[model samples]
Target chain A: MSSDPNSTSNAAAKPADGLNDVHTLSLVVRDRPGVLVRIALVFARRGYNIGSLAVSPGAAGGFARMTITSQGNPETLEQIIKQLAKLVDVVHVADHLEHPPLEAEIALVKVGVGEGSDRNQALHEVALEFNAVVVDRGKATSVLRLIGSRDELQAALSALAPFQVQELVRSGSVVMDKGRSVLTDLLQKS
Target chain B: MKASVDTGAQRLIRFLEHAGVEYIFGLSGGAAMPIFDALVDSRIKLILTRHEQGATHMADGYARATGKPGVVLVTSGPGATNTVTGLLTALMDSVPVLVLTGQTPTFNLGKDAFQEADVTGITYPVVKHSYLITSAQELPRVVKEAWHVLTTGRPGPVLVDLPKDVTQGPCDAPEPETIDIPGYRIPSLPDTEALDRAATALGQAKRPLLYVGHGAVISGAGEAIAALSDKLQAPVVNTLLGKGAVDETGPLHLGMLGMHGTAYANKAVVACDLIMSIGGRWDDRITGKVDAFCTDAVRLHVDIDAAEFDKTVTSHIQLLGDARRTVEALLPRVRPGDTGAWLAQCQAWREQFPLTFESPDDDHLRAQHVLSRLNALTEGKALMTTDVGQHQMWAAQFCLTRANRMWLSSGGAGTMGYGFPAAIGAQFARPDTPVWAIVGDGGYQMTLCELATACVHKLPVKVLIINNNYLGMVRQWQELFFENRLSGVDLEGNPDFVKLAEAYGAKALRISHPSEIDDVLSEAIAYADGPCVVEASVVKEDNVFPMIPAGAAVSEMLIERPTEKLEKPSGST
Candidate 1:
């Protein structure tokens, strides 16, 4: 652990190596009112900031699948997972720490294209390299939608940063096991 | 076939009756009128309290005493808000309480109508779970689910907010045959491999200590703990709420451990080679300076809540299950340790540093003396409840609780106004047993209005007030750590407690001198016609000793007042 108390950098602030590592947690929860607030409160109370979150109705009836990304000490994250599991609305909590699930995210990047031919050509080249498709093209701006892994999306955004990027929005990472087993299978067996 | 219809309020009351709820503690308000009216014809008795906070504490006390989920009913807005403290008290202590709060009509919920408040939102963090009923048809399912959630798997408080429109509306909904909470799971058995490891650790340790907590008391693990202690020849020290987990009078039992704990108990914690904590979280109060607490000991923690494992202090072996069941399972697999030397050392410490106070020549009563006398007079049989601060610690030191659920205090939240009302609740739960509320002058004034509730209900609870004209605990800290620079600790111009009790129609007594302690306590205990108040005017500036200053380790415990200036310990904010 770094003894420098003033260090705000994640690595120095954390007590142990990989303590500040970002983690994605998948939860299968009941489709009940206030379930989101309860789950969010669990993170908020522990001072763990959620980097991103995405939720949708689960394939299993009367349930919801939630994907939350947050960064904190792994010891504290273990406790957070246990606390989340204790919630009555939460069915299962899967921390993608050991298994390292297959993760993906989507981003819509709106860039200024009418600046010049050179800049526009450069943006198109970057989009092609990242396999991003032009979803909307306006007179001066073009919206490119990219679907890939989180790192790929980040690389694509960095590659397109020089073309006067106007606005960028990215969906939070969603994950699944890279095997035949399903996350919702436990619900059926229980 | 035609189904008969009833209003939501009627259905709620019927559900309570079906669940064998004997009492509901609450105050009436406009939004809850329908439910109150429905209660008029129900079998469950309603005990009206002066304040909603008192009602919640009463319910908490009742739950702690009876091991049944206590029920609370109050209106929306302020009524719901007032129960926050009591709910927090129950939540921190893991008491099972069900709070039913009235809400404004569903349409007016977000509009901020009269007597409106976001009750579920405000109480979200404190409750085990909560519900907001928008339709009368949902009452049956919500009530049953609420009870199930409140009573199972580490019991805690749950709230159900009812909108007035829903309660007044007609309902013909059928009760669910079985509760369908698939997400909730209760662990009944501990992992056998983990228990075997723990038993092995216990067998190898020459010096092992059982650090019990409220979980043991809640799980009724007294006999099992006693058995384990006897088999291993280990000494037992308990947390404040863990008072009755084992017989305090037993030869191997040490009193409460931590700040204001017995000196010998704290010493045992520091000296033990192996410590097994059962049903008790390693609270900051118990483990001062967590890194330094029991550092050399091999920790074995047993608790139903998995989140508590390695929460504050890491345990080498974590046994996840109910306290009683886990201990019973480990009994057959365990071999007794050779701890004769350790037992002798602990016993020697107990004799060398007994819990005692000096007798002043001025004849003014010492709070410690008064409490010891009360314990002797009651013969350790009375069900004792206490408010927070100096008197609370004194009571925990002197009062001998022999069985589980006999000692009830606000351990986690330490809410001051808890004692009198809790005693009332305990009286209601165990009508045959005598209940005593040991309170301080400052804490007694917080909820003294409950004197009316006790008088009206004719409860035979004895209220013993250790009247020192200051917030004794804070004042002690100010004098010791703050260079005697007093701030807001004084309680001057206080009303005469005897007169105040009389105004509330309660029998009152007073003891100003040391000679009057026995006579006054005897009179108050003998007066069983109604609630009685005995205010003992104790010496001011008296401090509780055997204290580990906040954030200081067990090594820093002070058995007496320091004659020189004191320095703040490290890691204390």
Candidate 2:
């Protein structure tokens, strides 16, 4: 998330990557009062800082899904999943990292396009190729909106910056596991 | 009673109102709309803000003003993310705030639903505590818990994330009960032995200094700090947060100590044989160089948070308890001491570095001149609000705070634009007190939108805008460090503040000359049926002096007033 070198730098520099006995669990629970609290309190009372959490309402009546990503070993993660499922409004709890899923965060990167269209056109073409939106445009900078994997967004940003770059804002990571039935099954359970 | 089957969201709002929350500042979106829907006809008034940042600062202002928990609500994802800055302000200032945010629906969980963000995870380090309400039935208990967490212990902001489904779900409101809070509870009194040890140390010292912080104000122990100082004949020094801990005009009061601290207060702290720290953690700003700070003194630290002990400075006697209770308990053991020479030394230091402005009295209106007039006008009844930078330090240095809880400003965070919202909060807290939000040109713009809230609320707060057309603090830095290569710091085009106030339906007064200061101040105070704005155009080059020069030790502060030299100028302007 942050360019704070402490966490990311350590992860990037280390070549030895054997999962680290860690797994990311993404759970979808019905968006209701205290549902997030119940899930979080369970983790908190057990002394766990959730790795990530993303939540939004579904297209149905009286149901929203909160995607909770937490770090633990297989056994602990399984226990948490089981406990989360037991929650009154929590419809489903699954580990999204290991399973097939759609994962990406939206980033609005403000890139400076030099003097004119040569740089702007090149960047605009690249954005079109990548299906990105130009949310903000100005003489000095254009905020190109990109929604994709962290790696992909970073790659695009690096490539787009042959011209001067101004500012960047990433809409933190949001993930949806593969298959249409996930939302349905969770809503039905609710 | 023809009652509706209320959802978890309604129950939460009901609990909030039951807890005596009159207002909730926030924005409504998908995950949290159910709560907003429930709030439509409720007793609690909701001020819909343009942005989450606005709500957070509004709540921040409300809390700083009222001495009660400020309440804010926002939708999940961007809504929750937007409030991070405000939460940090509350955390740093030790102001209690309750943030109610909507989370994405449970069914859409982890599937990366639209507008979903990890609120609790992101806010964990920043807040005192955070709660995510899962069950509709548990809404009452969760809200009650949040209020309790926000008010008790070292006060700070607490987050309650309510999912939309949970808000709409049908359930009976759960009764409030004491659930085991693992490690936190309102702490008991300090150990008798620790109290005795501290009292003994205080009794023997030749010169003792009592340092207080915002914790005193939060614990309702401002009187106790003053009492303890008087009882022991010890001079009082305050952290920026502890401005009104002792009446600014009272005897045995040196003044605020920190980076921009008075020279006397810093010297008193450094020269003291016994340093009794109450309600504050002797932070780096106060201590300067930790190793050398008060080397001759035996330190006594008392606070509710035990972790603060020995985290920075070594403490000979550490007491963990409420400031009021601890001071009360230690009173019987304390005996008066005489240190004429020590007092003389402290007064010498104070006279050496008096905070004086360099502005000529011939014409131009200076910020300090306004502060002086403000002090005289209010006669210490005014609740002074200060934004960060030259204006904030100036207000703290010059304002004669006579009443307890009269000075409100963000100290630990030193947030710019905080003065406006904080003044709004303080006015909300004490509606009768003459609240003034003193701000510089730069900081005034940060939460300028809150002026509308004050006008709407009909709060009779007087806004004193010290317009200098520059980020005066940053420009001051450029003058000293960058050799005056000022860029981006200059704010040339500013809105017509007087007209802006009129647009918001408030009385406006503009003062461009020194002659108009007294008249405008009196006029603003008298015309304050609702709210009023007084813009005083000050010189941009004016610099607040007797500075610690950033990384300098507390003892090494510039001992002479630079402004005095500017005023004298070695013979006439």
Candidate 3:
């Protein structure tokens, strides 16, 4: 299941409360073999439920950044952060619950309008309202690509539901700070 | 080429020799042939074990005994899989052990080649850090990094998986001048502000208690703990693994608190107003009911691992640093509280409920009696290691230890089959010291294969097997909590251990009566030419007392067996 977009909005969640509240943790780690497995094992060992995980090469060489959405007790999450920081390959771990980071997700949806111009025109207006672009068009089906916050993507999907949505695929949330500060800045000081 | 270059295996051996490693406990197999051959010309002696698990336990024992990183080298697949238990054992106790396992050639890594296994994937959860080496040039750096990670702050096990092709390939890489591990940091002195607060809490405390754990032993904080105890006029209690961190013979010391601990130690924990924990996590065994464990006490926790703070039980003051350094820093800042009445109350409890057992007027001997006699004979001078069981708890109660590292047991992991092999490792670490392995009948059978290793090396390790023909600890639980419905606790058709040890070329003796304990133990101890075995046939169903039932509060401890018999569930026999 995709992570709930509303969980990160509430910064005042108490420790050991709301076991199902999703948490977003960003980790900067060394680009070494088995680093991903090492990081994943830390979550699995603690029985924390990971909703979605994304990893990509870092801006600098010999490094990688990972975004993980998991749900567990906040107290246990604090211990999990400490355990992650203990890993030799893990450089930094930042939880986005306190200061919600700038996050976005992209989704592609294919809808069938049933060979009617009126329904096709209605789908186009719905796409326009949600700022989605038509990526492909067929006689009775059309594909639309949407990029926005998780809530926006949900609204767009619901708006297109009347047109017989055939398929949908989504890229998990990617995040960054609102300012110029980089996570790797901590690396230089250490 | 100007000259013949060294293979990766040869270079690894050379690096280990340069690192001052004296022994490598390993079992050789197909994929590990190159490394085994490379050791032919090296100064580090290799102790071949009967099983890979035995080899790992031996290395763990050596590390615990000497405070040096114990090294192990083994083959792929089963060899690598078997070391998982030993690695977890060391990891749970914060012991430093470096394991080197051979893998299939790089091309056959994920293809499921013969004798191939995903070494790093299999061991990631248990190890502190691991490496899967694909190229020969990475050996120097990996070896240095693994050693550094294993022996540094919050020491634990580290693994290096070397593919066969990588080790067989040629290498000429130079050793790095410095270890560049940026993410790995060793905590220095703790903040003075936290120390000041902890000292103030101690100053205000009327009934203070010093709770010692393995961290105190690891950081050599025993002298400081004693100084703090005397300065505050506070009584001291140790966790199971924390037994030898401070001298148990001292009057201020209450030996081993928690489940199966002394009643007086648990009583002191209940009465103390402030509890200062040094190097010991608030494990479930010690804090039986966390909410009720010293609820009124002001908690001060000092440890090197920051993750342990507020993990199970929240503390008011957290000092994150080496235990010795933090305690030493707090010494001058602390003001002694007036604890004369508190100390007298604890001493009265100690006198009222001292650790004792019934010397029954019968033919059968008791495990507690055997251990108490052993303690008297050794005079708390021997290095004692025990496997997990009722015998282990009895040994912890009766066999007093005098210094750090003097008593080693599988505390956190509760691993059976750990004692004999660990005794072999300890004997190697301290060749002149008296090494003893106090084991149960069940656990001794798990690692008795190592008897050959001890005999071959002529190591003077004494193995005392408390043979009661049952898995004593499990049977005790079934009898107490399960209406005496004994299921798989019986060990029927067991081989005679005396004959078994003799078959392995060890001097073996069997003693069944209490009167024979001193003579049999003296005979075994005097037989110093090689390893000796003494199988004491003890009472079959005796259980360890002063027990706090699992998940029960410390106040709910059963100081003795229930006087009434439990009613068995109705069934047709």
Please list all clashing residue pairs in model 3, or write none if there are none.
none
Question: Model 3 segments beyond 4 Å from truth?
Answer: A1-15, A180-184, A187-190, B1-3, B564-573
Q: Scored by CA lDDT, what does every candidate get?
A: 0.90, 0.75, 0.88
Candidate 3 B-chain TM-score? 0.98
Candidate 2, RMSD to the unseen true structure: 15.3
Model 1: per-residue Cα lDDT at residue B369: 89
Can you give the DockQ of every candidate in the order shown? 0.33, 0.02, 0.28
Ranking by DockQ: 1, 3, 2
- CA lDDT, candidate 1, residue B70: 94
Decide which is better by TM-score, 1 or 2: 1
Candidate 2 lDDT over residue span B432-466, tens digit each: 88889999888888878877887888889888998
Docking class of 1: acceptable
lDDT of 2 by residue, A125-189 (tens): 88987778988787677888898975688788877777566787776567666677565564555
CAPRI-style grade of the A/B interface in model 2: incorrect
Identify the runs in model 2 with alpha carbons over 4 angstroms from their true place. A1-190, B1-4, B560-573
Colliding residue pairs in candidate 1: none
Give lDDT tens digits, candidate 3, residues B1-573: 234999999999998998899999999999999999999999999999999899999999999999998999999999999999999999899989999999999989799899998888989888989998889988888888888888789989999999998898888999877997767889968887888988998999999999999999998899999998888788899998998888999989999999999999999888888898999998888987676777767788898998888777777788999999999999899999899999889889988998889865468699998999899999888999999999999999999999889888999898999999999999999998899999999999999999999999999999999999999988998898788889999999889998888899999999888888889999987889999999999999999999888777788777999776543322111
**TM-score of candidate 3 on Cα atoms, chains taken together:** 0.95
Which candidate achieves the best DockQ against the true structure?
Answer: 1
